[model samples]
Target chain A: MDPASILLGGFASGMVLFIVSVGLSVTMGLMGFVNLAHGGFAMLGGYVIVLAMKHWGLSFVPALALAFFAIAAFSVVLERLLYSRLYRAQELDQVLFTIGLVFVMTAAVTLGVGPETQVIRLPDWLRGQTDLGFMTYRTYSLALIVAGTLLVIALWLGFERTRYGARIRAAVDNRRMAQSLGIDVGRLFTVAFALGSGLAAVGGGLGAEILGLDPNYPLRYLVYFLIVVAVGGLGKVTGVFFAAILIGVLDFVLKIYFPKGGTIFIYALTLILLLARPHGLFGKRGT
Target chain B: MDAPHTAAGQLARRHRFQWWELLPWIAAIAAFFAFPTYLAFGTQLLIVILFALSLDLVLGYAGIVTLGHAAFFGAGAYTVGMLASQLGWNEPLSGLLAAAAVAGLIGFVSGLVLLRTHGLTLLMLTLCTMALLEQAANMGAHWTGGFDGIPGLSFDKILGLFSFDVLYFRSQYLYVLAVLLLCFVAVRMLVYSSFGQSLTGVRENLLRMHAVGAPVRARLVAVYTISAALAGVAGGLFTQATGYVNLSVLGLERAAGVMIILILGGYGRLYGAFVGAVAYMVLEHMLAKAYPTAWQLGIGVTLILVALYARNGIIGIGEALLRRLRGGGQA
Candidate 1:
């Protein structure tokens, strides 16, 4: 019932959503590929972190880094072998292929680690409540907010200020023209795909406690990711950031009042918003 | 001499009954006698065929990409479930009609808002609509039976003559077969109709259809309603056959499963439902039995292979073989 806690909790949830979904936007908007398996990679990332900490006796921070690098490397291989082949395919084919991947991934995860929820124990510094002068908030939520803000800044600088980021932007704007201008658009795409998927992995590792990791993690949260990307305007980092926060807060607050019908409201809102805009909140007409 | 060359003649030729079309019907009937012990499975196959056919109408023919066609199917099911269990309206025939009506109404209402968007937005909207319906059903657990589902639903005899025989399942099989026949005939007629051709035009190019004054949205809405109604009937039939209804009817898994069936058989072709259902059921039956736990791996591999190599599905592969046999290269 407390507004501050609601805002803090919802904002933290939103940050996780943004981290996981921004890669989807990049793949969907820039590559023009309907990669539904993005969540599968995120799920793998969760498993990577869980396994690293549980079995290897690794610390939480190292496990998080390992999740990012491991999933990133794995995603690059998948991009080259599986995804690149279907770049020119129809939306239907892309959807089917990615969904197929999700199925395989889910089945594999379930087989490997029984069909149970994987819970991670947070370190002392990251657990419990912290006084924010105005009100007390969960230290985990505060950490998520700070970490998410840092990522946003890092992404902004990477995309806006760096030559590589500018090249990625140019490629997304127009592939053929970017290629004609001596940019290796294909290689650029692979790098972007890795980073995007890696970021999703990091998000999954961080949000495993909140999101609940299981065999069906990919399918369970696929909608939230899609909502973030679609409502934010595909490929727009800032747009996804705002959309994720809005959806997260709305979902969190609504659930407090109407536990059973909170998701119903979200779905209805998405229907109306998409019907009116067709594109998204920040999308231009054609793109 | 020029009859085949004229547009009207070509339409007539395409609509004309083919002798080979009778083979499937004969096979369906033959299964009743051949598989006397497997009547229950036979009935399920018929229901799946009907469900897939309904989806083919919307997704394959009308070209609407929906991830939640199960919404209509679930609507039809809960309609039957609620009416029979709660209101004591247990007549099989009337219950099905009510199911179709309720499902069609939902399709019409949702389609009005849903058909406005295209691509990913439209896809998301359809999914949202289904999710909303599922949530509503879950919230109204008292009426819907919640996740436990509406069970112990009893129906009166078909036409008040043949009672449901749980032991033999003969009457259930025949009744479902009859309904499937009627639905298939109606779908065949609709597909060959000028209205159906106009839907194809809309699918091919929405802007061109708009420019040509083809009332694109109305046609879409009409087909969507009809498809929903048919899916509802399938759901109603499922409830009647088993005398049970569950929330899984509206689950995302069912939605995805139906799409997988359509893709396996090759969508856009009228017979795809028949081929796809048979393939899917048989594979699911065998793989689930064999693996017990990891059968989905088989399905996943099949889907990926189909998407990568056989974009058009099994039917497409057959057509390609036929083309090669006739020495027609890539027609």
Candidate 2:
């Protein structure tokens, strides 16, 4: 592969990772709950998209929107029923609970969809390659890059400029202050968790073309996403974005150059980064 | 400090064990030795018990919520398998030593990174380490035998005396039991030592320990390394017992299962890990035999109930019940 192509591929992959991980970062930042089930939500989205498109013959756009909404809805129920109880519990309890949910969701999917690998076929429009001046790129990947960039910008503006975003920021910065100021902190938490889950779902739906849909996909990606969240710094959106891209790019470059030791290379990178900045690349101290 | 002294006082009280307390444990070990003939499943249970005990050393006693404890176990198994198949080291002791050494080194190195972070970060980092190792194992298909796993690895006599036979499950069970006894004693001694107290102190309050001039991080790392070594020993024994080593040993599911075992037995208690392991394996065996596919669902439900209601696990619940029965006349 050309250097440019590798870079582009890295960029595209990073965008997918960023989308998947930012939700986890947000939830961790806002709620201080290490929601390991974030990957489950992503898997749920992937399975939903695959099922909707393949079995129900829904179009990509509708299926993606439906999957996003479905995961968001699921998150609401999860927040009310499970996460509320877990918020004040010890970190281990939260982890165990989320880990349990991972198994349940995985088993549920396996039971419903069987264990076979399901491919989410892209539409004909997304199947073509675009002729750039220097390199030819897949239209869908390029489209994803554009969409991901737009999403990031929108998220940035929403969080930084909007009143609801300020309320969320206030809640995250100081729960008591936010509540004292008459902001509904409980509702903010639910909304934030829902948003996080929804973003993961979106990432899952979009990247299903590349990642593929499988029952074990969530467990596999869970650590990678967490690494992104951890390395980027919890609750720091920009940190997640940069960390995801760095990891995605590094993973791609290493995999292409040293296929045998790609995983070791990734781990080595993480270890180095962690040693240098234990709080992560963008995380603040004590957070 | 006060809590530690109180706990030490409680430990002293518990050490004055009645004849009945000793009888049950002795009978349990005896049954473990002799019960393999009744069912081949008992041998498998023995190995799992060892695995769980190794976990308790770090999790239960040291208060480390490690999700990657299986890394050492898997590494140990792979090391033994690789050594036996490639290097032709049929000596089980040498294999076990090699496994333990390698696992201990990895544990020590990673513990430096892991011990820095508390709670969720440590949990996630350990999981990452395990995941990374599992991927590396999978990627190194030629060396580790990949998904199909390394087979055809056989052992001669364990320590040049005990012959391992596939048909005779009794010998294998005894071999595992002997190793388990040695490990159990060593772990018991370690837990009773000052080092063990330091670990508990670190777990209870790192800041206070640090302020008091205790090397909390070093103690934690040491405990982690020791736990990893024990887990490695268990893994090496597992390979010897089964004549197979697979990548699934290091997988997340196995790690999660170990956590479940810790929960089932009761954390911080030496024998809890053993009880949890036995219960898990027994329940899994029975449930799988009966339900086949949905057995995990049953296990999942059971774990949820245990986490929610039975905070201290099955052993704690049993002890509570026994206490209630003993005090019934007073009430």
Candidate achieving the largest TM-score: 1
Cα lDDT tens digits for candidate 2, B40-133? 5766666667778888878877788888889998989899998988889889888899999999999999998778776556766787788778
i-RMS for every candidate (Å) is: 1.1, 2.5
Evaluate residue A145 in candidate 2 and report its C-alpha lDDT on the 0 to 100 scale. Answer: 85
Each candidate's DockQ score against the native complex? 0.73, 0.36
**Residue by residue across B7-30, what tens digits does model 1's lDDT show?**
867766888789999998899889
RMSD of 1: 2.2
What would the per-residue lDDT of candidate 2 be over residues A1-287, giving only the tens digit for each residue?
88888888888888999988888888787778877788889889988998898889999988989988999999999789867886876665666677767767877887788877878888888889999877789988888888888988888888899998888777767878889999988888888888889889989988877777788888878778878887898777788888988888888898889876576767656756766676688877763
Would candidate 1 be rated incorrect, acceptable, medium or high by CAPRI criteria?
Answer: medium
What do the candidate models score in CA lDDT, each in turn? 0.90, 0.81
Q: Tally clashing residue pairs in candidate 2.
A: 1
How well does model 2 score by local distance difference test?
A: 0.81
Best model number under DockQ: 1
Clashing pairs in 2: B60-B268
